[model samples]
Target: MLILHRRVQLLQMTLVDCTREKFSKYEQLLNDAGQKPEFWDVVVITARDDSQKSIFDYQISLKKQRHEVPSFVKYIVISDPPGVKVGSGGSTLHCLEYLANNFGQHSLSQWKVLIIHAGGFSQRFPSQSVLGKVFLTLPCSKYPIQMLEALLMMYISIPGKMNYGVFIAASDVIFLFNEKGNWDFRVPGFVAIAHPASLKLAKNHGVFILEDMISPWGKYRSDPSSPAMVATPKCFLHKQTAEVLKHKDSYLPTVPI
Candidate 1:
């Protein structure tokens, strides 16, 4: 079953239209920057828990329902004090090391990975729409697992030639998962009411932050069709950015496979 499952294609060809339509805005940004508009295949969600409030319950819930999520979507948790140990060691930093060690063995030349922290950042943008908004933060989008793919797309897309990419803030968090979730992996066609983490694909990951620098003003475009697209921010780039962020090359200690 393990071998057979690995060979199983994680995404469906039929989702192309939905994916493209959802990511049209980012595609436009990429076009403006002359970059390819492609979505990422893997996502790493960085989560943490305080002594007063614990995100571990959520983490445990994810492990119990891991198989239920699509194989393409990978969930991770990084705790401040470090929570339960599923498989990888403790803390968000350790989790990232373990992932770097294990996934390093595989070829990521054709893959892209998005790393997002549980607590998103806040930015102000001029628009008739929402402003002074906190984007991609967990409180805004409580569905961490569901937000994995789409959230990563909101930041940037991974280039096909590279195996690892990151979109971390200066104080961003990186995470990992030791054991897979317990849920069954499957994709559904459409739903009026469903969880965000349950979707097969949301948008393209490659075309994020097409602008070279933070523009003073521009329209913050959000897909009217997608109610879950809280990470939408237009015409402005974060003060900090990276063209091709990698794990082994990053500040974190290199975890060799």
Candidate 2:
């Protein structure tokens, strides 16, 4: 088992008030720890053309901090070809495919993939952002398509132990914490429901499971505050789950996701 000192981090919700100062501090926090690349890795992507020079510089500063950031904790950026509508979800899918194909699933040790959009900032974008949410909202997505796809992929990918923390950030910047006395990014429940609980169910069909764990045939919906999202099998997914992901264009897009 792998373990590291957990940092209390902050999760950004919007681009508004997105001054360099606000997040710049977090970079220092990650760097002070002298993070080795093998300790953590992140794959961040952009759907539209945005000035990521700032974000890049921010990460580079942190990555270079031998005292805090690990020389081994490598980060990369990917782009979808122009004209191809690779939204948030698609971007994430594409990143995963690219990572798996080039580096193989085992490339990064304990990896984390953040599928954020250039235009879209975060969940708080529409409500609090200075500009409109540029994230491509899928026709079917009351939520954003990229966001849904990201969550879906994360839902499936996380069951197994990952190299980098495998995640799909629809349009949010990742920050390493110093000691804010807040959220712990190490725990999976921040985004996923715990597995092997009693509510576990096995059903059938190409069902769009409404709960945390996928049910075969049933469609479930839940209250925002309720917990029993879905029942999950203990341990990780077997090779069978990987076979399921290989179908159609399940992997990340070479051009986009």
Per-residue CA lDDT of model 1 for 1-257, tens digit only, reads 56434322222222344444435544353345344345455545444334212443354355446532233344444433444533212333554564667677352333455444443222232331121111222422224433332444334322332334433421222121111122211122211111121011212122222222112111111111222211222222222223232211211122111
Each prediction's TM-score versus the true structure: 0.30, 0.36
RMSD of each: 19.9, 15.2
lDDT of each: 0.33, 0.38
lDDT of 2 by residue, 39-67 (tens): 22554545343344344445446436633
Best by lDDT: 2
Q: For candidate 2, what is the TM-score? A: 0.36
Worst 10 residues of 2 by lDDT: 1-10
lDDT of 2: 0.38
- State, as a TM-score between 0 and 1, how close model 1 is to the true structure: 0.30
